[model samples]
Target: MKKSLLALTVISTLLPLAACQTASNQVATAQTAEIDDKSEALKLNELTQQYFEASLARNPLMATFVGVHQYDDKFNPPLSAEFIQETRAFEQAYLDKVNQLDASELTGQDWLSYEIFKYDRQHALAGMDFNQEYMPLSQMGGAHTYFAMLGSGQSAQPFNSTQDYREFMQRARGFAEFMDSTIIFMQKGVESGVVLPRPIAEKVLPQLSSHVVEDITQSVFYAPLTKLDSLENLTSEEKSTLQQDYVAVIRDVIIPAYDRVYQYMKNDYLAGTRSTVGLSALPDGNEWYEHKIQTHTTLPLTAEEIHAFGQREVKRILEQMTKVKDQVGFQGDLQEFFVHLRTSDEFYFDSEEEVIEAYTKVKQKIDTRLPALFSVFPKADYEVRAVEPFRAASAAGASYQAPAPDGSRPGIFYINTHNLKAQPKFLLETLSIHEAAPGHHFQIAIQQEVEGLPQFRKFNNYTVFAEGWALYAESLGKEMGMFEDPYQWYGRLVDEQLRAMRLVVDTGLHAMGWSRQQAIVFMLNNSSMSETDVVAEVERYISIPGQALAYKIGERHIRELREYAEDQLGDKFDIRAFHQQVLVDGGIPMPLLTEKIQRWVASQR
Candidate 1:
């Protein structure tokens, strides 16, 4: 979620001493004030570095993902009471120190960095007020899911040497302890009346139970041992020893840990899960959902405003769908056309490889035309792959994982082929554009490679800018000459409709007290989505409120900014330069992004 960086929570309010004295005294006082400003700026920079370091130390998984190896063998610090209090104190102390500085004295990127740091700290503190730690794991993401990926030898954790094998064994120990701690947190959730919806809890059971295999060789935890032969540094004897140790950990520590969580979810947690779908049903849930909306959208919009906006967008896109239906010479209403698109065998693929191949071709077509629109491209390349089977059934249609800062890993676009019928052929071009080329891969990889920015700016994400930019990227399919067929053009409209629908369904479920079935029915009536896809998406909103709102909200802002720039500059407006200006600052809150872009527009005049 993004938060406002322009709202400086702390500014010095004290007035300077009297200037009516002798001119010499006044001049001396002025010099002292100037020195104080520089000294404060220096202190703020030092504090930013310190806060980043503390953040990495507290989150070892984040450290490993960013290419920092020092914490590779450790799990994240336990979410115990003591750790929470200490973290609160740490943020408060930094907030106090940063608030004393005068922003008027800072200039250029230094000032920008200060705003980001302050926004980050204050946002972190605000989130601490929520009891999110109590409901730790979810169907969406948590230690239960991510740990399996990390241990699989196919994720960020490397498995190249004897030392690497040993480090994982230590990590496996930490995993066991972490699992126990998470169960304790879930128990706390029960007492506090904070619980997952029954549907979400049911989804989590299969995810945990998937890892409880009878054979050690089949366990994802034992994946590294299977690949030991590929590591040239490990001798045959060392490989044999590591294999024995790996099996022992999976058999004794890892498998049992999963079984424990599975049993708990099935026996105790399921019965107590919430019956109502909306966050507003829970204690303080309305306030929490409001905060989520602000965080994800980085705006002060109310639920009612977002819901109404979504309704208007959905109606407009449906009208566009009608034009496409008539152009294709279909013989029925919009709903019938949707059913034809959903159920027709001609629109579906037979195999997962065929789906991957279709996206590969789309990439080829889009790459040749990118130079016409973007002057700045990422040096880090990207690859398309299937979402690993373990989580595919529950995963979104398509998602991207950013490249590593050190270039050890390229960015990945995970296309979910779990249900072929759910992935229509016509949708490939827009999905490819949004997830692979100019969407996440381009925005994220460029941010990673940006020079001279703080590490946070380079790697952190603002959901509105990131998801919004991706949604906006889908519109470029028409400009790039790929959506030539009317049906393919309809695919782009379908994509827009999904985002617009999110505004309605997410707010409807979480804010307006709409039931899960009601939201699903609303989506099915408006779009050509499969029942499977609609169900999955609605459940996602149920689990994570207000997150889906970022897409349309963000796209609307970026499109508005472009229109403003074009109107102001007229024939002088360069699309390439406008895009570069948006991406050069990396992911930031929309308010800050708006200010920076307005400045650019004024300068161009």
Candidate 2:
């Protein structure tokens, strides 16, 4: 953006030209040019707003997630063919328009915004090449799974109002239709030979049937009805009427929809599904996985390349773990150490309450220590709580949900205490830091609150940046003056190995044609994860190809950037400022993040 100076000094030859114009006229001309620049910038802003509105319309659930409630009642047609066609056209149109903007005239955030907007459209358009609709619902996550959470009234969907209840009822109908469409899509997959793996389909069977309760009140969908009495504005008659409608919808529409998918999954789809777990089992499967790698990591890394990186990372992390084990004076080799860590009651809790209490303490301890490493903190404080029972089995041991942008809801750091042993006490420090403060909560809540960025920039995620930062956050425990316990340091290594192994196992399952059991065994051999949790994690990779690679790959790049900063800046390096610069812009692409850091380091020098 640097401009060459064109001297406008007076000279003997220019005397006549200078005499032609008055000072007032020159000022007026300059003022008009400045006005024109402002107008052009405003024009660009208007286009981004238009793009934001269309994006919200296309993904209503996303709107609710970020506290935009206008689309709370809606659902995108659950990956129907027509919806896909519309999405393609929508992205193409915006991409064309964005490409038409004059890049030379834009600078600062406006220029950055234009570049990211164009990149997003291009990335999304490229994704349209894959037939992801064929495999709609997975035990890992899908509309049906998220809708269950919303219906439970414990998620982003607000249930305090009569309108909120009615909107959910409306969503129940949309969900049923969505399930019907999902079946049709799967049927298309069956015809096209792009079906889910048999084992993943099996895992989903119980998830579907679990929703079909004999008593309406017992249903997860009935949670709102239970809260109707809390709506003090509602008359007794209105509350009773609302309760009836809620139950009726759950019984007639919702439960039947669950059963329909269940029946299809159990009877029709399971038989139709392929026994092979990898995407390579289907047509153009390898390319589909490559696209997923690009999508999740925002890098053009192939499966093999990622797998190689993962293998090296696994070796490096294992060496670090060995040092920890030796420090602890363990007599066994690394694998034996893993077994001892996994089996020993000395490191586990028998009760869910005890596990929750332990995690809460981790949160409390980390909160006080955060300022040592982080200068910025989230305004919306997060809570440490146990994961809800319904999704707990499939969920990771710990996960984070960002706070509502409008401050209506706090960020939730969910600890899945379903298997108490799986929630090992030693892993508490690293896990809490990853899922709560100075990690997901800090990156996401701060991103949501950052002003002057486009709405998409504020809310959109390039997950490599998000999960990568969280994983990187876990590595910060030592700098924060934590990990005094060798076991806690081992826990850090365990989590890092998990991310590293993801690069191996995700590619192994999808690209190298490794079976589900092979991936599970590889994870079990390398890490101390319980068999039950290992299976769930392996299935998660199978269900969502290439996503798991994000954490490790992203963390690696960010750490490299940080190390580069430290090496270059040396005594001048401010750890707090380096973090601020990395996160000042929300989760951006890896290359862009690299460029931003390189530029910052130069500025500091």
Q: For residues 1-605, write the lDDT of model 2, one tens digit per residue.
A: 00000000001001111111123233433433343334456756766776676566556666677678887787544545556665666666667767767888887677667777888889877776877778877776666677787788888889989999888888778778878988898999999998999888888887888898998878888877777778877799898898888889999999999999899888898889898999888899888888889877998788889999999999999999999999999998988998899899999998888887888888888888888877877788888778788877666677777778888888887888888878888888998888777888899889888888788788777778888898899999998878999999989999899999999999999999899889999999888899998888888888878779889889989999999999999999999999999887887899888878888899999
Model 1 C-alpha lDDT per residue in residues 533-598, reported as the tens digit of each score: 999899988877888999999999999999999999999899999999999878888888888888
Off by over 4 Å in 1: 1-42
Q: What C-alpha lDDT values do all the predictions have?
A: 0.79, 0.79
Per-candidate RMSD, Å? 8.1, 11.7
Clashes of each: 0, 0
Cα shift from native, residue 353, model 1 (Å):
0.7
**TM-score, one value per model:** 0.93, 0.92
| Decoy 1 TM-score against native | 0.93
